[model samples]
Target chain A: MAVITVRQAISDALREEMERDENVFILGEEVGVWGGTYAVTRGFYDQFGEKRVRDTPIAESAIIGAAIGAAMTGLRPVAELMTINFAFSAMDHIVNEAPKLRYMFGGQFKVPMVIRAVGGGGRQLGATHSQTPDAVFAHFPGLKVVAPGTPEDAKGLLKAAIRSDDPVLFIEHATLYQWRGEVPEGDYVVPIGKSKVQRPGDAVTVVSYSKGLQLTMQAADALAKEGINIEVVDLRSLRPLDMDPVIESFKKTNRAVIVEEGWRSYGVGAEVAARLYEEAFDYIDAPIKRVAQKEVPLPYNRTLEQMALPQVADIIKAVKEVL
Target chain B: MKKEEYLELYRQMVLIRRTEERAAELYQQGKIGGFLHLYIGQEAVSTGLVAARQPQDRMITAYRDHGVAINVGLTAKEVMSELLGKATGMSKGKGGSMHMASVEKNFWGGHAIVGAHLPIAAGLALGDQYRGGDGVTICMFGDGATNIGYFHEGLNLSKVWDLPVLWVCENNQYGMGTAVERASAVSEIRQKAEGYGIPNERIEGMDVLEVKKAAEKALAYIREGNGPYFLEIMTYRFRGHSMGDPERYRESEEVDCWQKEDPIGVLHRWIVENKKATEEELKQIIADVEQEVEEAVEFAENSPEPAPEELFADIYAEEV
Candidate 1:
């Protein structure tokens, strides 16, 4: 096992895919010379040359639109949106074209494309720069939304996303770029639409994903010492959400807690809670408690920004309430 | 152009016009449902562009794209069936009149949203370039689509990357009754290409020969590994934006003036005058097109409705 940062794992996935398929190319703003904003593709420009590692203008719509076009025809394009917040400019392309091209055309075409976008609110970059809008893309039926917490899932899910016939929206956390984990070397493909039981406990089930999964596990360690054990279910893929493990965990522990960095109203937690209620209503001991970011535009002030985000304390509190 | 080529182009234009006329009639008869945007007067643009296509080249256009679809070889039967929501439709009854795609013929799509396909066109070009292929993607849109930001972005990206693409702006006077002059800040659509450092020119789209000449020039430029080329073909949509549009935006004189330059009528006269074909031969061509459209309408009427189970299918490549 090789310990690598989430950024390196993602870059490895892209490198392996590009090396495997001649049609696979990367296009985005500063993806060439600057080697990506977070340096995820530090040496891609030199290794792949300008044609394969293309540098595009700051036109989010065109970046995604071009990828869909290329994908529809013959090539597999990996488009970087710079940030998920910038995706709003290209919403029409993502919502209308990428998802509908195959279905609307009688399944004659496939948009074999992947859009990598970064999201999170730890940075002091106000509301626009810091956002967790994975739910927005997940709402669309045709797209596969994957947000990985660990470096291993980042590498594995990305490789799977690149290989999938359908379009996949790969959402990464802005803060988790340097988060190191034991990533297995060689060909590793984590299947999409599957969740992992990060930790097993008997008292309560704590379901979370992306950065929230990291926070949930940290909170679970402290709760375990108190003899109030918590099971952690990391939902790797947000769209074709792996609810089987979540349901099994719910069956094991009647109490459930959902943690997400997105807003509370009609968010991911609401969907999971509703599903849990429908599937395991008879096994429930308490109502599902949800811990999500406060409903407001994230502030620029560091303290207020951190306050608006879902923290470890929030997860412990939600799990305690469920218990 | 060869005599056979001129005759074929003429036949295509007449067939498109006849097909659209029958489609309008079917829409009024309630046989075909949903938004119907007819390519009434601008048949020459699609005919000329498709005439200049190579086997590997791709073609995509805006909603007013029946003519282009037919020109690119989507049988009128499938297009009519798609418009009627029959199971035998081009898009398996999923896409209506607004989207008719013939996958075999390299007809990428007839996208509904204006200016959306420009970047897709660029990407198609990028794909060809990546594979070391000389094929180019011809993307068509209305004058109104020029005002869209994607148009600028797509053009710039294609130009910067030196992608193989030919951008055709069919400046059909109006976009849903708003004239290009009223809506566009830079009414001369070809001028927009200069900002992206792309070579651009304007052509009289009323003439098929002029359109064909322009298309050939642009295709050659792209085939030689040059960047994207822009062609603003000045044309007009003789009908309203869609079937329901009252067209209260223009005057009778304006419509009559454009109708006088009807592409099919103009091409028919040109073919006869240039000795490409005799008047009797042209009459036979018209009769053939009329019969073809009649048969297509019958085919669409006879085709069965899409099965209810089909509604859940085609939403994704794999089972959702």
Candidate 2:
């Protein structure tokens, strides 16, 4: 086992995959020259050289669209957007092209590519920079969405995503780069569409992924000291939303609280809430509490930005409501 | 070009035109659903440009791609069946007129969105470049696509990376109903390529020989690893934008003015005047195309719809 930050874990996974397959290449703005906008690909350019580690112009749509084309051929391309905020420029190429191409072509081709989008607020990069639109991507079918909450899951899930014969929207939370954890060495593969019970308890079930899981974990730890015994189910995958653990957790606890970094209305948490209603209606003891970002364009002001996002206090408040 | 080449080019152009004409007829009969944007006047562009391409080269285009599909050797049966939404269609009836594709033929596929495939084509070129192959990627689009954001982006990357990609803009004059003059500040679509420093030229698409000559020069340049080239094939669509287009965008006299230079007619006249083929030989070429289209329509009509089980299948590659 190797202890590394999420950023290094991502780099390790990419490096390992590139070494394993000559066909795999990484391309994006500053992915080569600047080591990456977030430094996730810090040493990759020197190691992989220019052909494999490409620095593209600041063109989001072309970056993704070109990746799709390359993926459709033989190459396994991992395209990094500077941030998920910029992905809006390539929404059609992402939503319209990548997700549907496989099914639409009647399985003649596979878009075996990973679009790594680093997202979340708190950096105060302003309104456009802090948007968490992973939910928008998950709304479409034929696209696998994986959001890891730990350095371990980050390395494991990314390897799985690169090897899978489908398009994967690998969501990396911007704030989680410094998060350090034990990542297993050599050929660690985490299966997609499955959730893990990070902290098991019987009082209530808490569901979250990516940076939202950070808040959930803090809240769970605080409540545990107070003898609340809240169970934290870290939803590692969003699209093939691993309902098994969720249903199992709900059935055991009979109460639930959902947390997310995106808007509250019709968001990832809302989807989870609806699913629990349909599948495990009788298991719930109270209305599921949801702690999500307030419905407003994230502001430039740091204090207002913090107010817009879900805090650890918000998760605690939501969990208390269910308890 | 050789007589054999001229005849082959003439045959495919006639076949594309007639197939689209039949498709228009079927659209009126409600046999075909969805928007049908017939490439009637633009046959010479696909027929000549694609016919000049090497087998290893990748060819992809936008929604108006039936002509390219046929030119690239995807049978009319496959194209017609796809249009009819049958199980035996090119895309198993999953991708109707807009998204038809065949991987085996090196036709990457057609994208419904304008200018989206341009970048993908660049990606395909990058794939080939990485593999150490000399294959070029031919990305075809309508004139309206030049104004799209990705068009410039895709072109810029192709130039910067020095990838072998040919950007063929079939300037059929109108984007649905809006003409190139109204939608874009620069009337000439080729001017868009200047900012990217890509080698570009404009060709009269009404002459298949001119299109073929231009494609030959561009492909030669790309094969020598000279980077991407752009060719603005000045063409027009003889039909309405779609089957139900009101087409209030341009005057009838304007349509007639371009119609006088109808690509297939002009090609036929050239073949006759240049002694490429006799009148009877050209007539036989048209007859053969009619027969081929007839068989294709029959095949499409007889082809079965996808079974109910097929509806759930192909929705994903594996267990979600």
Per-residue C-alpha lDDT of model 1 across residues A210-246, encoded as one tens digit per residue = 9998899899999988898899999999888879999
| TM-score for chain B considered on its own, for each of the candidates | 0.98, 0.97
* Model 2 chain A: lowest-lDDT 10 consecutive positions: A314-323
Candidate 1 lDDT tens digits, B1-320 = 78888889988988888999999999999988889999989999999999888988899999988998899888889889999999999899998988888779999999998899999888988888888888989999999899989899899889888989999999988878888889998889899998888999989999888898889989998899888899999999888899999879989899899899999889888888889899999899899989999999999999999999889787778754
Which tens-of-lDDT digit does each residue in A1-323 have in candidate 2? Answer: 87999999998899999999998999999999799888888888899999999988889988998899899887899999989988899998888888888888888988899999999999888888899988989998888999999999999999999998888999999899999889887888999998999988989999999999988888888988889988899889998888889899999999999999999988999999999999999987999989899999999899999999999999888888887
Candidate No. with top TM-score:
1
Docking class of 1: medium
Off by over 4 Å in 1: none
Instruction: Identify the runs in model 2 with alpha carbons over 4 angstroms from their true place.
Output: none
| Model 2 score (lDDT) | 0.90
Writing each residue's lDDT as its tens digit, candidate 2 over B1-320 gives 57998899888888888898899889889999998888888888888888889998889999988988998888989999999999999889988998887788899888888888888898999889989999999999988888888888899999999999999999888888998999988888898888889989888898888888899899999999899999998999988988888879889899899889998889889889998899999999889899999999999999999888877776567776
RMSD of each: 1.2, 1.5
How far in Å is the alpha carbon of B76 misplaced in model 2? 1.6
